[model samples]
Target: MPTRIVVDPITRIEGHLRIEVVLEGNKITDALSSGTLFRGIEKIVENRDPRDVWAFVQRICGVCTHIHAIASVRAVEDALDYRIPKNANYIRNIMTLTQFVQDHVIHFYHLHGFDWIDVVSALKADPAQTSALAQSISGWPLSSAGYFRDVQTKVKTLVESGQLGIFANAYWGHPAYRLPPEANLMGVAHYLEALNWQKEIAKVHAVFGGKNPHPNYLVGGMASAININGNNTINIERLNLVKTKIEEAQTFVDQVLMPDILAIANFYKKDLYGGGVRNYLAYGGVPTVDVRNPDSYLFPGGIVLDRDLSKVYDIDLKDPKHIQEFVTHSWYRYDDPQAGLHPWQGRTEAQYDGPKPPYENLDENKRYSWIKTPRWQGKPMEVGPLARFIIGYARGNQRMRTLVDDALKKLDLPLSALFSTLGRTLARALETKYSVDHLAGFHADLVANIKAGDSAVFNPDKWDPSTWPATAQGVGYCEAPRGALAHWIKINKGKVESYQAVVPTTWNASPRDAQGQIGPYEASLLDTPLANPDQPLELLRTIHSFDPCLACATHLLNREGEEMLNLRVI
Candidate 1:
């Protein structure tokens, strides 16, 4: 008999998620990923002005704020067949790259770091030995023995008082945690350092977009103005401030983040799991010339299936047959339960067919999750850093190929090792470093464009409602920090008729489709061996690698007589 285990409201992720797995002995034989909340942000933006969609849709997730706004604006622009200025494109690219660097670092240290790191063990680490270990890894300025001693003292205070705060509710002494006390101490030190450093880097978003979390964006272009001599606008001093922040971010990635990843990865080289589906997708990031041209993207877009590097398929976002969403195992209703609908014709009718609250198990044979199953050409695909890296390496991008090769060489691991849970984690760190290296070039280009007397940021040619066509539709996409994200829109009489956003987590956390194929999260967990079934630390290690954000994956739905169900799992 297989043991059924439920880890509801998965902690440290963005929103409510329940993961149910069936364990035969110590091995996971099957898994189900559930998004308990209803995601209906599309219904919220219905019949609104196309220009204002960016602001409303951006509120989907606080962590992934800017990307939604970018995608929404691009969708509106695409519908109108409008083109933005080069400077606006550069500014948008800069904002995105900055977000990637900041988001990835925060995910590794604060959100996903605890999975592999044992914070309690840091209390027993020798400060001198930890300092030596930290120094051996990188040239970080705060690697003195006294500094390590201070960090250890802090952790001791938290543990002794029984108020671990952010460090609470973790499987601290689990057998799966393999890092030594010294390495754990080093990780804890940087964890706090990253907490302090995160806010400063966010100032870049403020400098460009006016605020963090919910940054202001314009449909035609950016809302920020450029006047080199003006203090109120994006002038010389502000641009220089942006430059300084980028440089600081690059330094931190090189010295602190990369070294820590390498060190932690070295300890768990052989504990490989969570490589799912082996079908990768990236919608190309960081546009150099324009978003329309795939050739100019920093991370080129393509699809690689079954771990094949020989052939990469071209993706068309507008083609109906290319991408479709199925709700066969989802909590929504369609006229035909087995039919898959594209975003332009996607429906969001609320229908609950699962078990009531306090239920021990979900009817997986029926509907189980609020997340829709998104398939590329009728096949499940994994998206994110690993996908981007695999696609880039397959396409023979010299920089991407060289970076992945060097990292594998340092770890003495083969290229095949990159498809596991560790590979997803390593890909994110590597992509962060890669993004930082390109940050300077974008900054330089921005400065040069401003100096060349092109200060235009917004394109007002088609800004008026009178200039719009009676009916139009478009798709906007971005390779967000998590993976590929896009928003599809249909407009009529200058108002949104239909709106749908197929986010990154939806792709990775989706349930089985009409064809009965499990999603990336479920597929990855199959055959994974759990040392102890009671404490599912190994499940977390693989799931967190995708950096699951349910807030973005599942939006809210308002229905009369519908009571919100909140489950407290003890």
Candidate 2:
């Protein structure tokens, strides 16, 4: 008989996620991914001004903040055919790059690092040996014996005090953790360092968007005012501040993050599990020119099926056949459960037909999740860093190919190694390094544009509702830190008639569709071996690789039609 293991509300992620697996002997024979919370952002934005939808939808996930706003505004702009100035595009790109640098680093260290690193194991490390390990990897300037000792002391206090705090409740000493004590200590030290350094990156968003974790975005372009001479606007000092932050991000990625990724990946090279679905998708972002032109995207957009790199299929957001959502095994209703509806025609009618809360098990044959299954041409696709890199490499983007090839060479692994959990982790770090390298060039371009007296960031030509057609619909797409994301909007007489968001997590964490096709998370768990069923650390390793964000995946719509605010999903 297969043993059922349920891990509800998976910790260290941005929102609520539940994973259940059936263990036959030591291998996972089946798995189910569930999003416990519901997001009602789409319902909240209905009948509202299309321009104001960004502010509402940006609240989908606090961690993935600005990407939602960017998608929202881009959808509205696409509907109205509005084009932003060069400076505005540059600023948005800079902000996005900063997010990539910050989010990826934070995800690797604070969220996913715990899977491979044992905080308790770090206590056994000799501070001197840890320093040697850290110094051997990179010149991060914080590899002193005393520094390791100090960081170890902090952990010791937490351990001895019986209050592990953020380091609490983990499966320490798990057999799956492959890092040695010294490497673990080094990683733990960087974890603490990252907690402090992440604040600096947030300042970049603040300098441009006026706030962090829900920055302001405009319909046409951005809300930031570019005036190098003005104190109130994006002045010379602000631009310099942005420059310094980007530099700090680059230094941290090159010296600390990448080295740590490479060092840790070396240990888990053979643990090549969790490849999941072979299909991948990337909407692509960081526009060098206009957002509408996919060719100008720094990360090229396309699809790769069955791990094939020879052919990259073009994705059309407006085409009903390209992208569609299904609620076959989800807690939602459609006239025909088997039919997949495109975003413009997507519905969010909540229908909880599964087991109630506090139940011991969910019927996998029925609706068990709140997240909708998103498919490209009826096929489930993996999204995020791994997909972007795969598509980019397939497209022969020189920089992307060089980065991936060099990383593969360093690991002494073949390109086929990229189809595993470790590959997902490596791809994120590489993407961060690549994006950070471009931040300077983007800042330089912004400076040049402003110097040339092109400081306009907003387009008021279509600011009025009357400027919009009586009925219009458009799709805004971008690659968020997690993966490919898009918003579909239908505006009627300047008011939003319908709005749908097919977020990254929806594509990855989605449950089985009508055809009984398993989504990425579920598929990834297939045939994965478990060293200890009680600990289940191997499960965390694979799931965390995708950096799941359940809040972004499942959105709620009250059947009673009441305004939903301050509803907590414990």
Candidate 3:
């Protein structure tokens, strides 16, 4: 008899989840990843206007809402063939850069730290001792004695702010805590620093967004405008402030963030050789509509396989027919399994598509699932920080390459550094630092263009549905913090006929391999033992690493207490 593994409602990330591992005595033989919470977002947006998608999709992710809104607008613009002003592109990039900074800081201290390090570690830490350490490596700010008192007040506000999420449970003495005390203290101080870092960086978005959490981004060109000092064409002071902040943040990235990642990995040397996949992908980051004719766009999208970490083999995203979705055992319904469909034209029917005689078999095809397995080039792939890290590392540009190489060396190994909790946690930080350091150069060029008075605002009309003579389709794939993600949109009747979105977690936390082979999560659990049958830390480690967000995914609505047309076999 196979052993049954049970994990009921894993906590602390974005959504609800259940885990079951089939164990043969002491070892796991199989795994089942259950995404039990389903919010019917697709049906909610059916009759809404194309523009309202920004607000609707923003609700999908509490942390990365701004990106969702921007991506939606980008896709809609792509369908309408609208050309945005270059100024709009610059503003959009800055907004995204803010989100990236804040998201990176939060990921480092709030989300990933709770699992391995203790919150109370800072409480026991000597203020003088940590301050001295900081000054030694990152001096001046704490050069005075009074500054130490100020730091204490800052730390108090963060821990007591109650805004960083419910992390009191993640403190040093917590029952599940693992890392040594000093490391916890070190991470906690960074936690406070990160909170300040994100809030400050958020100003960039606030200037354009009206506010954070969910910002205002108008579709088909630009919404926010740059104004002069009430008497000029531009607010040179404010713009320069933003420019300065980018540089200041970059300095922090170089001096502190990268070094911290290296220091932390030094303690967890085992992560370098676990769960690595030779395959990689990127949804071609940033826009490349001409400023530089290098053809090597900002984030060149493609599929990468191991043979050398440097070369990435990209798949053309312009070809919609080449991409397809399979909802085999998922809670979706389609007439055929090989349905070459994207989200815009996709359907989510909760009924089982397979024939079944009873409930015991639990055949995936005959079951209702909250998640739909997404495939690229007919196979599932990993995305997010690791994929982005690898892809950017392959680019081997200045800052990204330096930060990544240092991290790789710290893990005491090479390329295989992707698969475990440490890799997942550290990759985002590396990417964050890289972007902060690089976007400055991009901003400088934008300002130089403005100083030269280029007046390069390329805004076009909102969007004329009738004038859209082309019916061609495309998919926009981009790497999010979690993993590989893409949006598939099909336009018809001057409206969105079908829209499909496949997120990073959809690839990483996926249930099973298409041929019924165990997935990465399941495979990782093969030999791991649980301390108690009930509290499976191993399972939680893998799931949380994906940073599961329930709202981001689309699920079927339940009638009363069950799926409307659930099928079962016994």
Candidate 4:
């Protein structure tokens, strides 16, 4: 008999997530990904002014606040055929890039690093050997023996004190952990350093967006006003501050994050697992001067099926036949469970009539998750840094190719390895380095635009609802830190009639479709070797690689004010 393991409320992520795996002896034979909570932000936006939609949608996820705001505004702009100033685009790019840097670094070192580096193992490391390993990887200034000694001492104190804080309840010293004690120590030291580094980088968003989390965004342009001498406006002083922060973030990515990823990859080179859903999808982002042109996007959008890089299929979000969401196995009632509806025609009627929680196993034939299955051309697709990198590489993106090729060469791995769990983690680090390095150029462009006397930010022409048609619809999309995110809206008489968001996690964490095709999370766990069913460290390593964000995927609340279910972590 296959042993079933349930890990509810997967720790170290943004929102509630549960993973149920069936192990045939030591290998996973089946898996189920569940999103436990739901907050219906889509219904909340209904009957609201289109201009105010971004503010409400920004609350979708605290971690991915800016991306939702950006996507929301883009959808509105697309409906009105509005054009923002070039300076506005540049400022928006800088703010979004800063968020990406902050998010990716935090995800790697703080959230996902624990899976690879055992904090308890770090206590056994020789500070001198750790220092040598760190120095060998990069010329990071803090790679001194004394510096590592301090980190080791700190870990020892945390462990001996029996108060591990963030390191608590972790599968420490698990057999799945492959990093040496010295490597673990080095990672832990950098992990602490990242906490400080992220604070400085966050200032970039505040300087431009007026706040860090849930920054202010205007539909026609950015919220920041341009004035060379006024204290209230985004003056030269504020621009310089943003520049300095971007440079600081770049230095950390280059000297610390990138090198650390390569070092960790070296240790787990042979452990190939978690290459889920080879079909990749990316809605191109980081627009240059033109937001409408897909070709000019820094991250081009396309669909790659069956891991074939030679041909990339173009995706048109407006086409009802292209992108659709199916609630076949989700806790929602659609007009037809088998029929996939595009976001424009999407419905979010909650029907939690499935087997109640507190049950041991989910009936796969019935609804098991709150996340609806989002398919591109009726096929499950994986998104995120890995998808973006692969699509960029396939499209002859020289920078992406160069960065990926260089990393692969360093790890002594082939291009094929980019499909595995390690590759997904490494792609985020690579994209961070790329984003940080190019941020200066974007900043320079913004400065040039301002100096050339193009100081306008927000265009108030479309602020009035009377200017809009009786009905208009548009799709706004951008690649969030997790993956491709889009917000679809239909405005009737300047008020939102219908709104839907197909987030990144929805693409990766969906349950089985009507065809019984497993989603990325389920497919990835199949055949994964488990060291200990009780301590499923290997399972986490694969899932965390995608940096799951369940809060953004399923956002609804129970109005009954009753505890629907409880998770017992074992």
Cα RMSD (Å) between model 3 and the true structure? 5.1
RMSD of each candidate relative to the true structure: 1.5, 1.5, 5.1, 1.9
lDDT head-to-head 3 vs 4, winner = 4
* Candidate 2 accuracy as lDDT: 0.91
**Per-residue lDDT over 1-570 for candidate 3, one digit per residue giving the tens place of the 0 to 100 score:** 775766545667676665667767655666666565566554555545566666786777787778777777766766666667777777776776666776776766666656666565555556666566555545326233344445555555767776534555433354445555544555665666776776777766766677788988777655665554543333677677677778778876766666566666666656332243446667756553431222444554666664266677766555555455566656666778546465555676665443333323234434434666665666556667767766766766455667666767756666566555677667777778766865786677667767776544446575555567446344545545565556656665555555667666666555553455334444455665544555555556555665666557646653333445442212
The local distance difference test score of each candidate is: 0.91, 0.91, 0.61, 0.90
Clashes of 4: 6
Alpha carbon deviation, residue 221, candidate 2 (Å) = 1.9
lDDT of 1 by residue, 1-570 (tens): 999999998988898789999999998999999998765678878889999999889989989999999999999999998899988999999889889999999999998999999999998899999999999989999999999999999889989999989999999999999999999999999999999998988989999999998889998889999999997999999999999999999989999999999999999999888888879998887789988888999999999999998889989988989899999998888899999999998887766777878789987789999899999999999999999999999998999999999999999999999999999999999999999889889999999999998999999999999999999999999899999999999999999998999999999999998778999999999988899898999999999999999988875464432434443444
Candidate 1 lDDT score at position 114:
95
Q: Positional deviation of 271 in candidate 3, in angstroms?
A: 4.2
**Clashing residue pairs found in predicted model 4:** 38-555, 38-556, 39-555, 39-556, 40-555, 40-556
> Alpha carbon lDDT of residue 565, candidate 1?
47
lDDT of 4 by residue, 249-353 (tens): 888998999999999999998888889888999999989877898888888899999999999999999999999999989988777778899899988777786
Assess candidate 3 and give its TM-score to the true structure: 0.83
Ranked by lDDT from best down, the candidates are 1, 2, 4, 3
lDDT for each residue of candidate 2 in 44-128, tens digit (9 for 90 to 100)? 9999999899999999888989999999999988888988888789989988888999999999999999998999999999999
Question: What 10-residue stretch in candidate 4 is worst by lDDT?
Answer: 556-565
Clashes (candidate 2): 4
